[model samples]
Target: MFTSTTIGDLYQIILTNTLICALEDLTTRLNKYKLTACNSDNVENEFTALLENNIRSSCLPIGVENFDGDLAAFFVIENVEKMILKPWGAKNLSLESISLGQYKNEIAAITIKLEDQRRRLTPKLYY
Candidate 1:
């Protein structure tokens, strides 16, 4: 039986789901840790590690043999640094609570670029 799905559709679906999973994992980690000044010393490294790990894991299900290893790493590090510098007063707020929206936007943009790349690779016949 023929299916309605095209390669572009498949690519988008896989990319979206993978990013969603990664975001969910990041959120869980943030909630668990409750980002605070106490952890500030290692937050950059820790956030970068968490984001990079999630992104790499997400790539596995999409059949990506090779990806720019530093793509997410660069963004995560930059954003986390910015977050740390922000004057968010009243210490009880979780880092995730303060930063999740920005992080979500970053992840969405990255996912879009991935989808665009995939589209370019299969141009003329799809997407």
Candidate 2:
């Protein structure tokens, strides 16, 4: 259902789906822990691993276009954070020239809005 042709399109699709998946995982984890939405460190780690594995398997170079707007920003932020904390090598580096900090603020704002919508739309009951 969510397939794409070009790398750019595929990247965007992957990002959107990943974000949705991560958010769902986050909400489930949060509810299980009885928390009201926390930071994204855990989700970010999961997402980074997932993306790294998929990218390696796919054998595709990460492009600036791959990291388009909000989705791209999220990837960049998580990536940089991981790099800082864990100190990994090129495996985590996706885009060549783009600094992860390039769209930092915008991405943060958009992500918050997206998460807010997700929270509102999530069903109170999972039946």
lDDT of each: 0.38, 0.35
After superposing candidate 1 on the true structure, give the runs of residues whose Cα lies further than 4 Å from its correct spot.
Answer: 1-33, 37-98, 123-127
Q: What is the lDDT of residue 16 in candidate 2?
A: 43
Can you write out model 2's per-residue Cα lDDT over 61-90, one digit (the tens) per residue?
Answer: 232344232122122343343111211222
- lDDT, candidate 1, 1-127, per-residue tens: 0122111223333454455455445445434433323255566555446454455422111232222222221113333522332111322212322244555455456557766776677648565
lDDT of model number 1:
0.38
Worst 10-residue lDDT window, candidate 1: 1-10
Taking all chains together, the TM-score of candidate 2 against the true structure is 0.27
Error of 1 at 61 (Å): 15
